[model samples]
Target: MAEEVPNSSNTVPIVGPEFARPQPSDLTIIGDTVKDTDGNKVFKVKTPLFGLHNKRILVDSNDSPIVTMKMKVTSKHDRWQVYRGSDLDDKIFTVKRPSTVQLKTRVEVFLKQNQTREVSCDFTIKGRFMKRACRIYVGDSTKIIAQVHEGDDRLVATIYPNVDSAFIVTLIFIFDLINMAGTGI
Candidate 1:
């Protein structure tokens, strides 16, 4: 009987590995920020030129994001970091480039710094190792943002979960409950 039963209309298939959307804001991430038409998961950051002269990038196709970066230091030493931050409404991943940092994506931005010194560039990654760094976070699940900072401390290549609530509800209410009830039929 259970095998012949039907699940509710709410039953949604377990899509793929789910993850929460990336939030704006990660530690002292300064400089400029702008939004595009999609409004989420597609954007860019302009950080003070840091690290090796060339860009070493990373990307996860499983995720839906790809970051291509090129930075150069002008004055002062502000460590570059990308992590999560709060915008009073939700959690956002931030890219902090303090002091003088000029940036440009496919859009524009509102600057927070009062300084006028930065090293910048317009670039695209064409290497395999670099291609591996700018990963993509796709679907409605959790994933880790692989990053490279200027320090002996490097986050191991691992996944940071982005848990989606609606997916969870569908799993519990539609699948779990229906399966349980059907088993007794």
Candidate 2:
């Protein structure tokens, strides 16, 4: 069952509280390892060097599969799907650019339950990737759930309390994929 955060009536718990810290948490992604402020490895990303779909798997510190993200090859908007626990059939959400062309980085996220209608985004990310700054907001509202910024040697994400860090990490992974492909990184 999902636990709701107090006063956040519009938000849904993507994962659970175990993924969230009581205070704002700083997660740094360096190479395959995602570390916390105390330099503890929290997650790892397994990316294929050569693959048709550019599939990437996120694993926990204990090497358990958390989620798998893959780009949709035929998508014009740079769409991607995130699946639960390495199962493609268990798609949890979808992420994509709002348009094929944009002045800055803009992404829309739709949870599995919202994909049928997709009348509006369940969450949105907006910012400049070159500047290494972006914010994830609740639906179309300005209630920010997480924010990402460039660190000295890696990208740093500051996830707000009670928000699912795994979900934020997944979004950041997709954001990196979209921007890096554009810059040929």
Which predicted model would earn the best lDDT? Answer: 2
* TM-score of candidate 1 on Cα atoms, chains taken together: 0.21
- Give the residue spans of candidate 2 off by over 4 A: 1-12, 49-53, 182-185
Error of 1 at 154 (Å): 8.5
lDDT, each prediction: 0.22, 0.81
- Listed per model in order, the count of residue pairs whose N, CA or C atoms clash below 3 Å is 45, 0
Candidate 1 lDDT, 1-185, residue by residue in tens: 11111112222212222333233222111112222223332122322267553221212223322333222234132212111211222211112223232222110111123112322211111112212122212211122122212112221122123333222211111111122221210
Candidate 2 lDDT over residue span 83-130, tens digit each: 988788999999999888888989999999998888899889998857
